[model samples]
Structures are given as C-alpha cells and as structure tokens.
Target: MSWTVDEVMTRQVVTVRPATPYKELVALMSRHAIGALPVVDLVDSDGRLVGMVSGTDLLAKERAAAGARRASRARAEQAKAHAETAGELMTSPVVTARAGDALARAARIMHRARVRHLPVVDATGRLVGILSRGDLLKPYLRSDESIRHEVATEVLGRLMDLPPDAVEVSVDEGLVTLRGELETSSAGDVAVRLASAVEGVVGVRNRLGYRLDASDPRMPPLPGARGLPAAEWGR
Candidate 1:
C-alpha cells in the first residue's frame, strides 16, 4: 500500500501574505507553535503559495540587526536587519510539494533542501495543506498485521500474479518473510522487490525457491567440436 502527502498532511495550515509585517509573522508563529508559514498571494483569493517565512529567517533579521549596532553593516545583513515585512524577510521561489505526491517524494525534497516543513500545493500552486517530517512517519506506526495483509493480497496476489496462498507471508515487527515455490528465479526476486515497496515494511527476506535453475551454465562444447589438433583428433 502506498501513502500520499494528503493522507497525513495538516489541512488547516497557518499562512501569511507577502506584505504582512515581520512582528506579526513572529506573533503568528508563536501562537501556532509552527516553525514556518507559507506566504500566499494576497491579491488572489485562491491563496497561491509564493514563498515561505521560517523562524530561522526571522532570527536572521534579529541577528543582523544586532550586528549592525557593533560595526559597519554587511550589505545583505543590512537589508535583512531593516526589513519590516514578511515579503522582505521570506525566502521566495519556495520549495514545496504537491498534495497528491508520494510520501517518499515529499520526504526526499525536505531532506535534500534541509527544510523541516513543506507547503502542500495543488496543480495550480494553490496552498492546500502543510506536511512535516512527523507526518511522513505516521505510516510506519501502522500495525504489522496491516502491512502483512497488503503484501500478501496486493503484492503477491495482484502484483506478482500468483495464487493468493502460493506464498506464505509472515511479519515480525516490520520485516516481511516470503517463502514458497515460484515459477522462475526472477519471480521470487520480483516478489521481494514488491514487498519492500509496501508502506510500513521495514525490510524483506526472500526465502522462496524456484522451479527453473536460471543460474546454471550452458553445456560445454562437445569433444569433437573443440577443434583439437589433427593428431589428438585421430587418437
């Protein structure tokens, strides 16, 4: 079974507009206890996501403001320190995820970008929800019995095109063990791969046997076909 971002995302996401004042952003974050907020298009009722303002971003401005009092201001920090609005402080061209996207896809983006939160958008880039690392991990908490059922009925039965009872499936914690006879060695390999893709499956152990020995080498050339020397052939 596969999980999508919408399945675990927070539907009621706190958001802000570009022109929202910096202090207001801080207050909103403090009240909601969220690390970040998606900045939406104020002119449009659709609330399309355009940027993200994070707690770190707010703190950067504070740090820059402090540094300015002690010495000559660096150009970028000077600009940030004087910034008074969310648009001025936010990171534009935001990293975001789609609501229908696979859970793994969203997690990968967050990991690569080193962001804790991701705004879930629609096809038109409208904000629909928000996803956090914690939301992505909710599926792993599913009961092992649920995972085993999907592997047995969905992976082995429907996906592998084998009899429902052909393979004996056992689950311990989150590991899946597959043991049975398959038509070919490749079939067993396919089963293991499919089982691994199922949500909440930590690992897969393939104990399946195959009817065909695909690994066996072909027969060697016959003695006469070796094309030996004339004397050896005569002997």
Candidate 2:
C-alpha cells in the first residue's frame, strides 16, 4: 500500500541545461510530447537539477509577444518573451518530489502547487525521474479479483478478526459491496471504511448489518476500536 513516486515515475526523463536554446527546448518538448523539462547544471558528470521550464512558461513568451493589453504588465512575462536560453526563462526554486516519497505525498504536493508534472529528485537534489498525475493512478488498474482477495483476507480476516467467510465481498469494476454481520455497529462502519481504502476501490456500498450498537455509552467499546480512527484505518 505504500506506493512511492519512483514506483510509477517515468525513469527515462528528458532534461535540459541552463544554456539550452529556446528552439531546442521547444523541439525537445514536441518530440517527447512532454509538458515540462527539468533544467539542470550539466557541468559535472551528474547533472544537478536547478530549475524547471514548463509549456506554460514557454507560452508566456508568446503571450507577451502578442502584446495583450492588461491593467498592469507582468514584468517577468515580458522578460521571458525576449529570453533566448533556458536559464533566462526557467522558473527557479522549482517545486519537486523526492523519488522515495509516498505517491499520496507527491499527489498532495502536485495538487497544492497546481502543477501537472513533478520532477523527482535524489537525496542530493539530482534529477532522477518525472511523476505525472497519470502515473499516480497506476494502482487503480489492479484487477477486481486481486482487490477481492485482499479485502477478504487482509481487511476482514486479519484486521477485523472476522472469519474469512463472514463477509461476502463482491467487486465489480472497482466498486466494492461488503455484505456481512458484525458484533458491533462501529465494526460495520470500520469494515466499510477499510474496504473503501483498498487500492483500486472506487466506491464502497455498505450492506453490512450489526448485532449490537456499540456506540451506546452504556455498552463496552469493541475490540480494535482504539487502534485507528475510521479515516486513518486503511491509510
């Protein structure tokens, strides 16, 4: 369940140098069908990432050339229009993700930064690979059969301490339907939440019934109730 950025990232990344020309940058992006390139200092044997230039960054030049009138001129955009080298146009202090970082962490960084691509780096900040939104979703491609087995054995049998056959798990195109009877209502909710957390699960339909309302203050708390919160259980 601990998916790392390197697990799904594109290893053969196309990088650029500080002195790379504008025309070459465009040609590289077009040839590779990529939206961004990590700018590196290639003086050393191992290229060290210094910045990044994206399609939007390249388009800024064109937008400036168009002379689109606005209330205030964006000096940076105007300067980029005349930039001839990667160093002059690239964005510095680039937002990046480490190769060993959790895919969820990388996804969060990408979402918060509003970026489509993430340049994955090594401990020393050397560019190693690239991660995209599409790559982060690779786990969702797991087969329904695999998901069912995990849910029955791992989620229900091991975690819930239920008999393997206690829960009837049905998976169809990543939609999971969990039907079973549990000793406590909270356990039923935990089952639904845990099944939903399984990788490749798009949605969970809780068809489970409970014999006892464990939520009642007079009743004793169910076993494993103190182990994890509902939201953090599957994570």
Candidate 3:
C-alpha cells in the first residue's frame, strides 16, 4: 500500500492571514519553529489558501534595510524587500498538495516547484495540513520487520501473485534481499522492481533464479513456457 501526504503531514498547521504583519509572521514562525507559513484568506468561510511566506521571504526585508544591493536580485525579490505585510511579502500562486495525493507525487511537486514546504489542501482548496521535507523521511523510520512483511505479503504475494513460500524476503537496516525461484527472468526482474518500490526499502538484492530467459530475444521460447512476453514485462 502506497502512503499518502495526509498520512505523514502535520494536520495541525500554523497559518497566517494576508494582513498579518511581518513582525507577527516572524514571531509565529519562531514560536512554532517552522520554516514557512501558509497564507490564507480568512474572508472566505473556508479560509482558503492564498499564498506562502517563508524565512527567505522575511530575510528580503532585512537585506534591503541593510542596503544590500545586488543586480542579480529578481523584480519579485525587490518588491518583497520593501513589503511590510504577508500580503505583499508572500509568494502568490502557492504550490500545494491534496490530502489524498501520493507522497512520491507530492515530493515531485516540491522538486519541480523548488519548495521545501507544501500546504495540503482539500477538494475545496481549504488548507487541511502542511507537509515538509522532514515528513517525507518518516517512512524510512519503519521497523525492519515491517519493511520485510510488506515486501513479502504486499509485493511478492499480492502484487506478483506468488505463493507464500515462493519468495523469501529478508531485511536489515532497510536493505531487502529476495531469494526465490520463478518461471522467467522477467518475473524476477518485476519482483525486484516492486520490492525496491516498497516504502522503507533502501535497496533490493535480487537472488531470484528463473527457469527461462524470456527477456532475451535470442533465447528460443521453450515448449510449455508460461511467462509474460518481453514487451509486456516493460509495463
């Protein structure tokens, strides 16, 4: 089972309104020990998310006040430097993640948006929670036994449709080792790939043996050989 953002996100989020003063924003972040704050519009009953303000955003004011001038500063940065309120300092068009979104998908969104924090929103675009880079690392804290169970029961048994004893899964410090005998090399490869994708799995060691080399076109398909075609295996 894949994890969702809501599962790992901090449900109790610290947010600020657009009208929140810069001093208040700084105080709030300091009190919460958070790097950023989601800016919401309280006028709407739902308090819909409007933007985001981070420590970097607050630093802009200090940089300008200190007379730090750089030609490389973008126009948006220049504007934020003189901004006094969250409405003016915040980065509009905030990047967000849905509660039900997959953690991997949310991570990709953060990467593409170049953001470290994401405000988790509901279908109505109301802020429900907040996700940070640290939250994504929570899965890696799963017990080794838990990781092994998932690989055996979820990956090999259900996903690969293999019997309970068909594959032997072992884990140590998040590294997974698979020992099994399958009908074809494609099946072994699929097993390895699926096991590697399991949460908390650091790596997969493929010790699986196959009766047929179906993946190699040069090898003739043996009589009574039953395995996924090479082209189909790519899926």
lDDT scores in order: 0.84, 0.86, 0.87
* lDDT for predicted candidate 1 compared with the true structure: 0.84
lDDT of 3 by residue, 99-190 (tens): 99999999999999888999999988899999999999989888899999999998888877889998899999999998978887767877
| Candidate 3 C-alpha error for residue 169, in Å | 3.7
Which portions of model 1 show Cα errors greater than 4 Å? Answer: 1-4, 68-76, 103-108, 136-140, 168-170, 177-193, 204-235
* Index of the highest-lDDT prediction: 3
Query: What local lDDT does model 2 show for residue 227?
Result: 40
User: TM-score: which is higher, 2 or 3?
Assistant: 3
- Model 3 ranges with Cα > 4 A deviation: 1-3, 72-74, 139-141, 165-168, 177-193, 204-235
**Steric overlap count per candidate:** 0, 0, 0
**What's the C-alpha lDDT at position 100 in model 3?**
93
Clashing pairs in 2: none
- Tens digit per residue, CA lDDT, model 1, 6-30: 9999999888989999989999999
Over all chains combined, what TM-score does candidate 1 have? 0.68
Candidate 2: worst 10 consecutive residues by lDDT?
226-235
